[model samples]
Target: MLSLGAGVQSTALLLLAAEGVLPRLDGAIFSDTGWEPEQVYVHLERLEKEVATPAGIPVYRVSAGNIHTDALDPAHRFASMPLFVKNGDGSVGMIRRQCTDEYKLKPIKRQVRTLLGYPAGRLPRGLFAEQWVGISCDEFTRAKDSGIGYALNRHPLLELGWSRTDCLRFLARRGWQSTPKSACVGCPFHSNAQWRQMRDHQPTEWAAAVAFDHAIRSGAARGNATGSPLLGQAYLHRSCVPLDQAPVDTVTAHEWRERQGSLLDLLDPEDGPRGCSPWTCRSDDHDAESAVAA
Candidate 1:
């Protein structure tokens, strides 16, 4: 099973498999969060028609639910994704992230089991599925185990000695260079540059992100850490301001002063260049203590 994230590296991996440069795959799975940018869906459609079809491979799409609706529903208060939040003391802290687990990995796993002919909630002992992830040599640190005994993680890109740059080159060579990063529109892991790109090039998505940011401002009524009634606000932008009004247009020295000693300060000037999938939020790099990605 290949985790088809619809991003550069994953797309390159699928293309390579289609070209018969790698072993045939059972199938590819794309776990939709239902909030990804429109371009991602467009790219998926292109791949389904041009690549997956001629390759004789099937691409299965699965979703647990609409994360946007799940997070905002008054009846069920799911924890907001680990977005950047400004504190009353002028500090910033990130909320704990559970979105990837709930929205990505679980659904893909469930679908993989069903594809394997396992009955719901019943798995034979020692069932190990070789799961291929698209992480390349550039993000080798992000390579990780499946963490469950039922699946084994595999990295074909790493074995091929491909870096992210190589993946881009491959796409360019194939005249399919427009593949966009795969991420939820409202992901707090976005850097100022990423936010600006959305606001400038993708206005509708930018509006949705801003709305989602405002929606999560008051902590969820049910699943927050306090486990009590809400008491604070949340902001998706590192500046702790509304996404539309945030200073994503420019990063000033004064803004740097305030962000000093904060998690955002330690991040690379931009977010990781790839989209995130289950088991790899990439937002964990918000912590200064977290391992750096190459």
Candidate 2:
């Protein structure tokens, strides 16, 4: 099965499999965080209706819970996101991230087990699934073992000597030119350009992101319910400020250089080029700090 993120690389992988370039896959599994950009869901629908269905490859959508709602529910034990925190001493840090494990990986794993014909929490010995990931050649470091014995990770993109640029070019030739990076709308790893695009083009999603940023300022709602509030304030923007007031419109020198790459090399400065995958999260690069301790 392919771990379909519906992003450029993963989409390319799915198409390649459908075209018989790669080994046929049983299906593609999408682990929804429920806070992804609107485009991601639209693209997934198109991929299913326009490609996967015609090719007889099933696409599965599974979710543990709504991340946006869980974070704000006072009675819920909200799994912390890697939110940027500003301490009293003016130092910046991040809350440890557990969202990927809870919202992405766990649900996908459960589905995998179900597909393998085994009951939850009780997989017998000598059972495994070949899980395909979409890590390209340029980002080979992101390729990792599946950690669990039931699933073995595979990277068809790297085996094909493809890179992010190659994926973009392939998709563009097929008339899929506007593929957006798949990620949660309120992901703190968003670069200035991404945030600006959301604010300018996707106003509704931008408003929701801003509202979520404000809601998490005092940390997870559960922290308040448990009578152990966060030590510092949380912010979705790395500037440690409210999302609506963030410097999204400003382009930094690093971002400028990144954009200067050939038209296909549209790499995000803060989160690198690739979007978040269930197994390989973009936040891996951003070291987590216990700044928002309860």
Candidate 3:
């Protein structure tokens, strides 16, 4: 089970596993993207100490890296880059967006494969372990038969017909605390509300993101071998404007709402409350809408 904080689908899976519904809930993993919210870090600690530890389940730490103890510490995380860069005419184009492949998917698959004794370059011809993903009932389309290796892909929430609400109810029954949706603090998937939360509660992080963004004005300009930068540069907080420049309580224009809603619809017409977690969201996904009361 791979969890990004207390998100609904994963939480529900944890509950079901503990109650013997799934039976063999062997590995519990987390992919720390280095820029997660402080609240998420706090909640992960509480979760690890109280419930996860007592359950005797090993919660594997498959992280990209941190500033203090970084391991190759790539500049891009799953949330930092978009898979497809659209042309000015709104047509899709190919761009280098391997954040998910690098930070989330690769590390996880490597760990699982290693445990199965087929680390890399070859598939385990005999192993048949199931690697569970937390995509909900509504997100079954994103569930594909991608890799052909040791473990089979399992989607318990989708099979059980449970929505995000069912997951939350199960968590509340266990007296667990709900934290913010898991993604990097400067995640490009963040909505205006999530961004505002970072700016208000975590000023230093917000500032660091803003400066890091400003340092790389254009797209490739700031990054390697890409273009130079974006037009006004690319800020993590959206608005293209600086993080400090974006108002916390800024009301969305009607046009902005329509455009944003349309984008969400493109990703999944049924998006509600929160967007899909990085673990389950499609690499092609670009929706930034959220549960913030507009």
* TM-score, per-candidate, Cα-based: 0.86, 0.92, 0.73
Judging by lDDT against the true structure, name the best candidate.
2
Off by over 4 Å in 3: 1-6, 66-80, 83-95, 219-232, 247-278, 282-294
Stretch of 10 with least lDDT, candidate 2? 285-294
1-294, model 1: which lDDT tens digit per residue?
789889887889889988999888888999999888899999999998999988888999999888888877767747458866656786667787888888899988888788877847767898868888998886788999988767789999999998776787788788777778888888887756578889888999898888888777876645554455344568887677777788776744433443553352232223333578676776644442221111
Candidate 1 similarity to native, TM-score? 0.86
How do all the candidates rank in terms of TM-score, highest first?
A: 2, 1, 3
Ranking by lDDT: 2, 1, 3
The whole-model C-alpha lDDT of candidate 1 against the native structure comes to 0.76
User: How much is 217 displaced in model 3, in angstroms?
Assistant: 2.1
C-alpha RMSD between model 1 and the true structure: 6.1
**Candidate achieving higher TM-score, 1 or 3:** 1
| C-alpha RMSD values across all candidates | 6.1, 3.6, 6.5
lDDT tens string, model 2, 188-236? 8776777888888899999999999999998999999899899999999
